[model samples]
Structures are given as structure tokens and as C-alpha cells.
Target: MAWSADKSYFFMLAKLLTYSIFGIDARPVEVEVDISPASMPKTILVGLAEAAVKESTHRIERALVNSGYTRPVDRIVINLSPADFPKEASSFDLPIALGVLAASGQLETSLFSEYSAVGELALDGVVRKVRGALSMALQARANGKKGLIVPVENSREAAVVDGIDVIPVGSLAEAVGFYTGVLPIDPVPFSWDDAVEEHGTYPFDYSDVKGQEMAKRAVTVAAAGRHHLLMIGSPGTGKTLLAQRLGTILPPLSAEESLETTRIYSAVGRLEEGESLLLQRPFRSPHHTISQAGLVGGGSIPTPGEISLAHHGILFLDELPEFNRNTLEVMRQPLEESRVTISRAVGSVTFPASLMLVSAMNPCPCGYRGDPKRQCHCSPMQIERYLSKISGPLLDRIDIHIEVPPVPFRELSARTEGTRSETMREQVIVAREAQRERFGKDGSLVNGTMAPQQIRKYCKLSKEAESLLKAAMEEMGLSARAHDKILRVSRTIADLDQAEFIDVPHLTEAINYRTLDRSSWTQ
Candidate 1:
């Protein structure tokens, strides 16, 4: 790591701390730069850097001269540490420029070791935004660095992690001046309340819909317990509309959950500039034609899929039966495990998939089979073919299966509106608080994620409730998974009612939610 400045003295600037993002986590990287007198002046990158990272030499050269620094007339060698693993994109430009300056004696700073820098450099010296700034900041804090120097636009996002200073620089000259004590720029402060208070409301609301009280109630229960829901109804019913507004009724994300969710979005470069953090629960609805790799994560680089993008939020699949059966089937494991692992030739990465699933579909192929006003044209075989697309295993994994019947004309014509989202959100929050006390400080964890041990412990049923469940199981031929789902839904129902034990009415209501499960859908 030694460089000759004037053939008289050797300079060394090694172990410049930085980070590289892989999947959702950041891996620490040390950058080393050396400039030595040679026959010809050329830049070469070593240590298994990718093509995009290797091409930063030209960018760094042009940026230095534009920012009023002389390009060194010597052979330059920039090495990214841990040579075994390959580095990705243009995030290394600023770091490489800084390394060249630090190594060639053009920039001298005593506090260089205390700061970590990452940004894409424009040929005109303007520092551009890079992906995973939040992840890099979190890694810097975890690695005991004093501060992070990132693009000006990403300062707030990197500042979400406390106990570290986020130094935002607009250009390479600003960064160089700050490191060399030529400029003094204060770090911006981040406020959790400010993000929440300033965030605007979603355009849709519960009050906009007419009369699907049953579907609304099922959504409330699903929101209360984080349970997955499936709605079967005619096409004109408000099932899709209800699913869209489900995020409105769920509780606001916790501060930790907000940051965690923001990190994932940031890793994928999905966070828009000026948006600090994801303050609300996410609602992701992929089209029915999405591939398995797109639904789950896959590729040589293995970026996040739709499930990972929906972490700590809602994943709505509208027109459920229209999706490929294989695509629908792949969700079963992640639904139970709350995470998906994508393995490639290089390695494996596990992305968080802990989300509430809400799916809606028509009762038959014609969409008017069960409607009172519309005449049915499709035969029973056609209806069976349509319903058969949704497998039993997937249905068994879903907890609540309520039929969203078409709204009656009388109910739709009434002047009065049904319950609003605010009231339902309040109820959900109360239930969530109770569950937080029950499951400890992890308020994000809910009854829906409980294992068998937890189910046996917290979801205790009374003697009468147990007898009723036994009779229902005998008559309906429910599987062991279905039985446990019933218990889980009953526990959530009880939590909503503020009851200590699962009562008969709670169990009965929970059983009623399993309409598709007990019917001939499986057959």
C-alpha cells in the first residue's frame, strides 16, 4: 500500500473503510490506493472488482481535474479488499477518488480514518446518489465508525440510524474540503415524529366504499392478527377495493420496523429522493403473470422479489385464480416461514417476507354464477375447473376465507355510511397493544406468526369450545393445519374482543370465516 509522491518519499493510504451491499445486507470493504512513477500513466483495478467498478478510473480522473485537482501523472492502482468476492457498481467512485488524493499527498487529513464515504461521481465532479446508503450507514455505525459521508440527497436516509453523524456532500470538492478541514458542514438531524407528521394520507379510505360490511369485518380481523385473507365473490363486488384499503386499517409501523423496511427498499434503489423513511405499512400487488423468480427472488445477482418488497406490510394478489398454479403454490412455504431463501451459483440470500396476504377471486369463470341478478351461463364443470386452479395446500395456509357476497340494493341505497377506517384502525391498535404485552416488545410479531408451541400455550380453548371444534372437524374433515389455523384465528378474535380465553362465540365466528375451507373447494 505504498506510493511514491516524488521518488524521494513513499506515501500510504490503506484501510479506508467503506461498505458494499449484497442482497439486503452490507459487507465491509477496505479500499487501498497507490500511485507510483511508471513508463506510462494508466489506472488499473485489482481484487476481483466488477466491470462497472473497474470503469470508475476514467470517472475519477475526469472528476479530479474538474474539481480543481491535478490528475496524478503516475501508474495508479486501486484495490478493493477481500479479493475473493467481486464488487458491484459505481458506488466506489468517490471512495477511489478520495483514496487517490489521500495516497498522492494532494489531500492530507488527520480525521480521514473516522469517516466512511460512498457516492457515484459525475464527470463534472457532482456527487450522485447511490443505492443502499442506509445499509452502508448502518454498517458504518455497527463497525464503530464516527460518521458517514454520502450524497446530499441521501443524508436523511443514512441519518435514520442514530449515534452516527451523516455528512452530506454535494460534490467531490465539498467532500475533499470537509475531510481536509477546508469546509465545515453540519450534519442534518432526523426526527421520527417529523416523518410521520409530514407524511400525507393515502388517497383511498373505508368511507368511500358502499356496503361490504362482512368483507370489512374480515379485513379488520385480519389486520388485528396479521392473518392472511382470501375473498371469493362476484366480480362487481368491492373485494378489490377492500383489499386496496386494507393498509388504511392496519396499525402504523413502529420506528424500528420503519427503518428495517426502509433499508430493504433502499437496497433495491426503490426509495425516492427526499423520502426519508417508509412511515406506513406497504401494500404490494403484483400482476397475475409474474414469474416464480419475480414473485420470489432469483438471478445471478439475486435481487429482492415481490415477497421481499412486501416485508412488514401487505401483499395483495388481485384476481387470485388467474395466476399460474406454480406461482400460487410457491407462496406456501414463505407464508409459513415468513422469509424466502434464494440460492444461486455464488451463494444464497434470505429476504424477509413477513407480510399479510390478501387475495380476491370470482366464484366461477363467468363471474355471474352466484349473482342474483345476472344469469349463470357456465356449467358446473367450468366452475370446478376455475376453482381447481387454487390448490388445497395454499388454501389451507390462508387463515380466513370469507365469501364477499354482492352488496344488496337496499344497503347500497342507504344514505348512512358503515364503519370508517379510523374506528377500525383504533380497534386494531388496541388489539395490537394487547398482543405486544402477550408476546413481549416485538410489537410487529402477531398471533398469525405463532408456532405450534405458541398455539398450544396461548390459544387455549374452553371445554364447550373444544367440543364444538371437535364436532366441526369431524363433520368438515379439516386437516391438522386447518385446525391450527382455526385456533390461530380464534385467538385473534378473542384478542379483538379483549377476552382471556377462547369462548364459544369466538370459536364459532372463527369457524364461519373458513367458508371455502369447509366447502367443496378442496374436493
Candidate 2:
């Protein structure tokens, strides 16, 4: 028999469903296999398969033989449909092998219609776990798949997605048995409320720090407003400690936010084994030596970077001045847009980066520029040159700039518990509730991300507060952006105070946050 373009001939070809990951998304691919007796006995894999995908044939052959299935000797042609798109990952091994069995008349083709499978096959028929199981499960549900066949290790990750059965298979033999109705594997069980209650709590707290009440207060304001914060202080002034506890004071992650954050972590293979949903907010602190691509997400395939992993969470850049200037500058766009878009020659990928940027740095090169106890050894020119590494534009984008002075010996030795995270979180929840009512229940709009028009509409100021802002703007030589920032921060402060309008005290606190940029150290 010869191959023809006739529609009726398509019925003889065996096709199974699978998926390929494309920038944190799972795109459906049909594994279409055809065995032609007219051609030589060789297997040909098409549809732009990458090296990893192309190399799976040998593994699949051994897996099939070990799983008690015959390896097809006829001229086998496997075409991953949507032929123009590039396909990667060894997850194609299972689906291609199954398609081969069906096309060779060893298995019923109709059984594959109910499920879409993704897994890597070992030589002895074991099925290995692959990345992006959560995204694949979501896509499978969207496409009306009855279930998704995944490795046992990925069962929990994929099962978190509702409305689809996740069939956990430990080996190629088990997968075949389940599809053939000879074996039954139940969908993994998940209780959303139970998972949240178990993993939602943070181990650290604000009270864990000995002192620095002022820093704690400033951090509360920043968290309440979702504002970027920059803490300047001497070494060991508890900058890192303050930054680490910021998450404990933040509101817990909503279900939607958890799914979004989990998808990024899943796509990057960062999820721990057997972990289903990420209940707590993510806290990503990339080292200062990270590259621009590593910070914002870029590759030939354009995977999600540190910022994307920190979606709806915190991105702490400790020792901020040590980071490359270009790498730090790359954050300007994502910070403004709440998303990072990486454009590759193949395509463009946009990743969510709606996160709180918390960073820490020493005041100067010697790490004691403003310390009362330590003698300053660095020359003024050296201090000036060191501070210049952080450009003015970047500084202006940060909403709150506060100095974290060293804790006094008396304060450190005090047995009293400092401010607790629970107390600050109550304040943050109240302030966030106010923003929700003001911005509507959409949960996307906050004071820190307010547009100019929104600021004009919502930020009402008292006459005295207006006068104070004008004087500060003049004395500090603030830019138009800085002016809007003051208004936003003022609006947040007023919310924290439960005040309806911005008053003198609120405006004064907001104005003081901007003073570090105008400090004499820069002069």
C-alpha cells in the first residue's frame, strides 16, 4: 500500500495527545505515528524536535521491549503536529512509544482519546518525572481532556489543578495497563484548605530581631502599600534580618496568586518533590553577581527569571550596590509595568513580575559612613564614587528609603520582645482592606502602582499638607516622578492611619522617606 492525501487514509494513522512547554505555558501537541510497509525499516522523528526530544527514540525502544510491548520494525514516522513550532524535553518518550504501539496494531487506538500524557522513559521501562506538570495539567483541563497521565513523583503537583484526573504512573508498563483498562489508578487527592493551613505560616517573625523599631515601622508602611523599599545602614545593622521578615508581615497568598506563582516555579523545575501548591508568598533573593538574563528571565527559550519567580512576593537584592549596574537597570521596565517581556527571535514571552522589591546596602564603601561608634576611613571622593553606582533614576523609583542605624547595646540586651509580625500584619491587612475598597475588589490596583490619573483622583490633600509637599519638592529638587511617589506614599500613610484625607503628619512622613537621596553623603 502507498501513502495518499485522501481523507479516509487518515483514519489508519494512530494519534495520541501530548504537550510541549513554551515559556511557562503548555501547548498541546498530537503525537501522530504512521508505520509504512512500503519504506525501509527505520524510525524518523519530525516536527522540529530538539536534540533532547530526538534522542528519546533509543530510550523508548528499550522501554517498550522491557514493558512487554513489541518495538515496531516497520518504517515508523512520528510527527508532532503543529509542525512549525519547536519541541523540546524528553517527556515525549511515553506518548511517542504509545503511538507506535497503536499504529502497529498492538494496542487499541481509541483508548488514547481520553488522556494526554507527559513523562520521560528510562531504559528499563521506569517513568521519570518531568518539569512543568502543573502547567500541563492546566492546559489539559482547558482542552477538555478527561485526565493527564504523569509520573508518580509529579502526581501531587499536577493534582492541585482541579477538574481533571491526574493518573500517576510509575513505569511504562503501568501507563499501558491504565490506558488499556487492565489497571486502575485513582486521581491524587488534594484538600485546598488543608494544604493552605499546613504550609501558609512563616517560621520567622519581626519580634525575632532585637530592636530597630523605626525600621520595623517603615517596613510596615512599605508592605501595606506594596512599595519598593531600600534600606541603607552599616554592616550587621540587621538589614538582611529586616528584609527576611518582610514576608511574615505580608498577607497570605490568595489561591489565584498561588497558582500563578506555582506555575513559574513548576516551569523552572524549582518545585520540591511531592509539593502540590505553594501556599505562602515567594521570597527570591538573587546574589549580587547575577547577570541581567538571570535577573529578568532570558534564554533561547526565554524561561522565567528571578523576578518572575518572585511574582506576588518579595525580591530582595541584598548588598544592592554590589550588583552589576546594567543588571539592576534592567529591572526598570518590569518594575513599572508589573511584568517582564523577553523577546527572542523565536517569539516573545511575558512573565508576571508583580512583586515587592526590597533591597539593602551599606551607606558607603567602608560600611560605616554614618555610624556613631566607628571611625570613617574612606575618603569623601571614594564614598561619592561608590554611591554613584546606583543611578538616580533607580533610586527615584524606590518608594521608601530609610536608614537602619545600629541597635544600641541596651536595646540588644533587652529581654522584651520587639514588635511582633502579627501586630504589623494586622495593620497591613487593615490598610490593604482600605485600598481594596478604594481601588475596588479587583486586587490588582494598589497605591504604589497608581497611575498619575488615579493619584489625582484618589489622593486628597489637606491645605497644610499641600504646603509641606511644595516646600519639600523645592528644597529636595524632586523630579515629576518623585512628586507622584510622594503623593502615593502619602495616600498609603493616610490609609494606615485610617484617615480619609492626607494630612500634615501623613505628608511629613512620606516626605522624610525621600530625604536619603538628598543626604549630604552624596555631596
Give candidate 1 regions above 4 Å deviation: 1-15, 440-445, 520-523
Q: Write the per-residue lDDT of candidate 1 for residues 193-278, one digit (tens) a residue.
A: 88787763677789878998878888999999999999888887998889888888887777877888898899988887788899
Q: Total clashing residue pairs per candidate?
A: 0, 0
Each candidate structure's TM-score, on Cα atoms with residue i matched to residue i, is 0.94, 0.96
Total clashes in model 2, counting residue pairs 3 or more apart in sequence or in different chains:
0
For all candidates in order, the CA lDDT equals 0.87, 0.89
Model 1, position 112: C-alpha lDDT score: 65
Off by over 4 Å in 2: 1-12, 519-521
Which ten-residue region of model 2 has the weakest summed lDDT? Answer: 2-11
For candidate 2, write residues 347-367 as lDDT tens digits: 889999999999999988989
* Ten contiguous residues with the weakest lDDT in model 1: 1-10
